[model samples]
Target: MGWISHLCLMNMKRRKTRTFLTILGVVIGVISVVTLLAVGIGVRQEMINTMIDSESICQIRVTGATGGKHKDRMILDQTVKAFQELDDVDSVYPFYELYVTLTNGKYSYDGVITGIPQSELTKKNYTKTSRRTTSNVKPVLVMGDKTASLFYNPDTDQTYDTAEKKKAESWIGKKMDLSFWDSQDSTSVRLEVGAVIDSGEDTYNRDSQSVYCDLDVLKSFLGRLPGGGTVYGQPLDANGNPYKDFVYSGAVVTVDDIDHVDAAVKKLQDMGYTTENEKEYLDTIQKYLKMIQLLLGGIGAIALVVAVIGISNTMTTSVFDRINEIGVLKVLGCDPDELQILFLTEAGIIGAAGGVAGVLLSYGFKGIVDKIAVKMFDLAKGTQIAMIPWELAAGAVVGAILLAICAGYFPARFASKLQPLDAVRNR
Candidate 1:
């Protein structure tokens, strides 16, 4: 072997501890960066799944306007007629909702009363948790588990008859008065309780305390039709005369295909009706996730820069210590370019070692993070922590090598330019 090659091998063997320590520093920095990116991607995927899986991705909601003393103004007949005529609109169901208090003697809690048609109810998969059948006479009402638990008494371990004194044997086949103020601010009729239904969703279950009879019952109570009408079952004109153009509060439209949600929404807007898609909310969520990923990746980048400085310092020190050796090689017929190449090769070796170790360390670090997070957050153990993308890993390896070469340049040049006599005499 040539003198420079032989010298590089000897230097590596003699400074094994320093070389290993520098490699370890670089490995830790790269591993941190990879792990952070992997976790961010996993979190984003989970959020997307949560948004798209359960609800109707292809559904759209349209609400009516409420003007002055007329709150259900949006439910006008003209609006429904126009929306129903839109292309690609599969089915439309009107909705009427009210807020009222449920009372059992001294105990009471506020709940929402909604009126839905049989066709819409069936399409939404609204099922009864307690009562199997809906009774027209009894006025069946479905309750979510949370709402059911609120009225539950620990002593009796039952809902209804607990401390509340309301004698509801079961949500099914029960009679209860639903008292609410009418349009003119008078207490309306007492609607009976019906079968309790379960939506199988947390938010829907908690918020939907009770959903009463179909739209017809709601219209009768409010003195209006599916679209807003008069208490006298007649339509009111702009001049306060009897008219026939009153509409309902809102409509829930179901589309045939989920992919057509956006197209359907646009069509409705063109028809002069407001349409909303679930993706609108998901897009807002994605914007926030992207910001978080950028912030986290930026933090990891600082650690990597520090690791580069460490590599630079180590190479500079090695070059300084071997000054006399380099001068002696030059006097013994070693070319100046050979001296520079030897030092550059040493820096490259350090970079390659670090890159390999960094990849291995990332896998181990991800395992630890997964175990700790699962235990602390009560997450399913099946959750996985992945390594950085292969492309990113490859890029990091190349970047590290390039950085090392840059860091070693000045030191390698200094060693190569040393006067043979001056370097030998100084040592």
Candidate 2:
């Protein structure tokens, strides 16, 4: 096989110009296939990055069932403890939310106040735009940027403009009146703003009207409002006496890894809690990206198909040129299997050369595409339009070699079947 392979390579060099042209066809085909698939890879990565830029994909939102005295369905201190004990679970952040009206000078905002742990603030992308979040022990509220937009002076600016930004900038280190209500009654609490945050922009305006405070501070004022101490709409021991343990309206569970989210959600469901699995969004993204990759790969395969035709043509011509040599080899007791393998090996060598060149050039092409996107569309420097992972490159090379061998099959077979006596015929 080694001698046969060497012979095939030597024969390939005899028709240097023809071989070069055929290899060039394969190179172009490989480049098209790799670059197109790379686009799919790049775009898929972009969507995932956008989704989890400041949020963890391994998180699940858990809430208590509505209208029930069921202890199993409620999110309580015990519930948090149980969630923490789950396998692969990282930590739990339980919080209670209350409707509140915030007032800052002449501006006022109607929003929900979340009482969450200080450690979970940064994990939820609650970065301080007003001041550095040095201490979480303070009894202060962190307002969202959009919430501050409503707190800007009506006379100064009605929209979130430059003036509104300046006004929001001053919203830090100020006091606001936080008023909340229950199904039975309502109350008010005054709290100081610790900082304002940029919770990233979105069309849904999820953070447009939200504020955060420490869990202890929230519990301190919960007793002031009617039904504040209630757990899942059920009062303590049916006696109207406040429960010693604090009740969380909702909680978020963080898994050690995204793959563990499904199992964690299942366990939470079994515990009688309503859960929202963030992994569903990721699964959907994966499905869509797989479809996109297939579509792009199919489109690129058309070019490779044309290159396969070129290989078949080259192999057929080579067989015709080497008809005398084929007859001489057959007469010397060369096996037909070896003859076929020789042609196939030669075709594979051509494919290998072209695939290597194409993969290398694909990297250069990726850089060029990224630069063009940055310059033409004003995309961020970090933005990319193409990505050739090792798997994709290796797959492309293997695919090219197989396709070349397939193309050379008929020519190799024709060469192997030639009669030794017919080789010298002048007809």
Which number leads on TM-score?
Answer: 2
Q: Which regions of candidate 1 deviate over 4 angstroms?
A: 1-11, 67-92, 109-111, 123-128, 136-139, 148-173, 183-213, 216-237, 241-246, 254-277, 324-345, 384-406, 409-427
The top-ranked prediction according to lDDT is: 2
TM-score of each: 0.73, 0.79
What TM-score should be assigned to candidate 1? 0.73
lDDT (Cα, tens digit) per residue for candidate 1, span 1-427: 3655576668888999988888887787777777787677667776677667755565687864544445334566556666677667677777766666655433444556666775555544444334443544333455443455455434555665444543222544444555553334444344444444455544452224555556664555455323233553333545765444545556777776666677888876765566677777777888998888788777776777787788788878997888788778889887888888888878877777787778777778878888887787677766764436677678777776777777778888888888899888868
- Please give the lDDT score at residue 156 for candidate 2: 60
